[model samples]
Target: MRYRALLAFLAAIVAGLMVVSLLVGPAGVGPVAGIAALVDGKGALGLVMREIRLPRALLGAMVGGALGVSGAAMQGFLRNPLAEPGLIGISSSSALGAVIALQSGFAAVSVLALPGAALAGAVVAVALILMLAGPRGPSLTLILAGVAISALAGSFTSLVLNLSPNPFAVTEIVFWMLGSLSDRSMQHVAMAAPFMAVGALLLAPLGRGLDALTLGEDAAEAMGVRLTRLRLMLVLGTAALVGSAVAVAGAIGFVGLVVPHILRPFVGARPSRLLAASALGGAAMLLSADIAVRIIAPERDLKLGVLTAIIGAPFFLHLIWRTRGQIA
Candidate 1:
């Protein structure tokens, strides 16, 4: 009953947030105006609502779902709830790829440059981590390798920005790093949706493997789970999801981290249940954060990542404190 109530509440919140995302923005589109525009031959309002707000909100759902499920997968596979896409360097590497594309002027040529570079970077990051950490290796070692990769990728991005002759690289990098759902178009959504959807399909079935993995790799292998194949699939799938997300929304952190952790208690630490629940929780959290970003500063507007980090950082510390004696 408690879980059902919580789920219902979350559902309500997400639905309300999505509506808010559609209605509220720079243009004054109130409920009546929005509805009239939708049903009647209104001015630019309906187009704005459809082309801009609709796609942005949809992308938010996808990206959040991707992050949440990926986080669940990472935690379930490692039996460590703290694992996240950012911590594993996939996001940073994807950002580096994006930066490379922008700096090389490919991003300016077409939107494909951005996602293409990002996906390639994501694939590279996962491949490098696999090599460095070894196939089906220690979770801790895998995490450490991820950290090193993040550091390297971050430095590379910084170096690229510094070296780029384009004077706008600094501000552009800031926007990309800060993360935003505003000003997004349907084209961006079209570019990333396939990768995100495909990645989800690839990772969803691995939930059972993740459940078996909680019993230790030896036990999982004894149960006939293919550790090597599972690891490869996880790495690739996470890269695809994280890459598409970062490619579009930039490095919006902690959705993956927070959602799964928040729902883990309800799901009883079971990986399979946790994955879908986290996806729902993540979508709720992200959509809510996005709505908050709009209303919190109706004048100048805050970036989505700013809201997420402000909220997520404190929760992160609390998590570290709470989980201190357990995982660390």
Candidate 2:
């Protein structure tokens, strides 16, 4: 009953935020008029509500949910509270792909090129991670492989940025790298939603496996939890989630890391319960951040990723401070 009530409360918060997200734009539409315009779909207000705010709100929720659940699964699998979705290099690799697309003018050629390239990069990184980790490798191996891939991808992205001759392209790349939901359309929602749904499906059944994993691998294996299968599903699902999110929204940081950490205590530190709660918490966090950016600097195009980093970096430091004794 308690868990259900918690979920219900989080869901209510998410729904309320979604509504606030739709209403809190530069246009300053009232709640009733904006919602009515959304339903009617007839005039300029309808277009603004449907095309601009709706997709931004939806993507904010989807991206936050994906990052939240991915972070929860990684931390659960690794038995490390510091584990994050980007720890596996998917986000970096996706960013690298988007950079390549922009540098090569492929992104300008078509609406889908950037996302397609980003997805391709994520697939390649996943393949590399799996290959390097091997099917039966331990968690340490996965961590090392992911670190290596992230380093390599980051270097490549820097190289592209350094060599690019087009100033306009450089500005676009920089802005995209910073991440934002401004000017996004329904096409992005259509592109990313299916992949996020697939990732959700893969991650949904992981509650039991993750719970069993808390008992250590040998014990978990003895109890019918297939460690190999669990790792594989986790990698694939996280890749899909992070890949699709980065493809559309660029690399928004610390969401996966912060959301799960904040909600874990509320869920009694159970990986199983943390999954759903973190998803909802993440949506609320991102939506709130998005709204904050709009309100704090309505005229200045504040980047969502920058705002999240500002919020998350200090929390990260605080977490490290608290865990310093454990680290030593």
Q: Please, what is the TM-score per model?
A: 0.90, 0.97
Tens-digit lDDT string for candidate 2 (1-328) = 8888999999999899999999998887999999999999979999999999999999999888888899999999999888999998999999999999999999988788899999999999999998999978889999999999999999999899899999898899999999888888899999999899999889888998899888988888899998898899899999999999999889999999988887876888889998888888888888888888999999999999999999988988887788689678
lDDT of each: 0.84, 0.91
lDDT of 1 at 40: 62
Please state the error at residue 98 of candidate 1 in Å.
1.3
All-Cα superposition RMSD per candidate: 2.5, 1.5
Model 1, global lDDT: 0.84
Query: What C-alpha lDDT, on a 0 to 100 scale, does residue 80 get in candidate 2?
Result: 89
State which candidate has the highest lDDT.
2
Candidate 2 stretches with Cα past 4 Å from truth are 319-328
lDDT of 1 by residue, 1-328 (tens): 6656766776676677777777877888888778667566357887887788888788878788888889989888878766886777899999998888877778888767787888889889988998998886767787899899999999998898777777787678777788888888888889898998888888988987899998999999999999888887887788888888998888898899888887887877788888878877888888888888888897775899889989998998888788779764
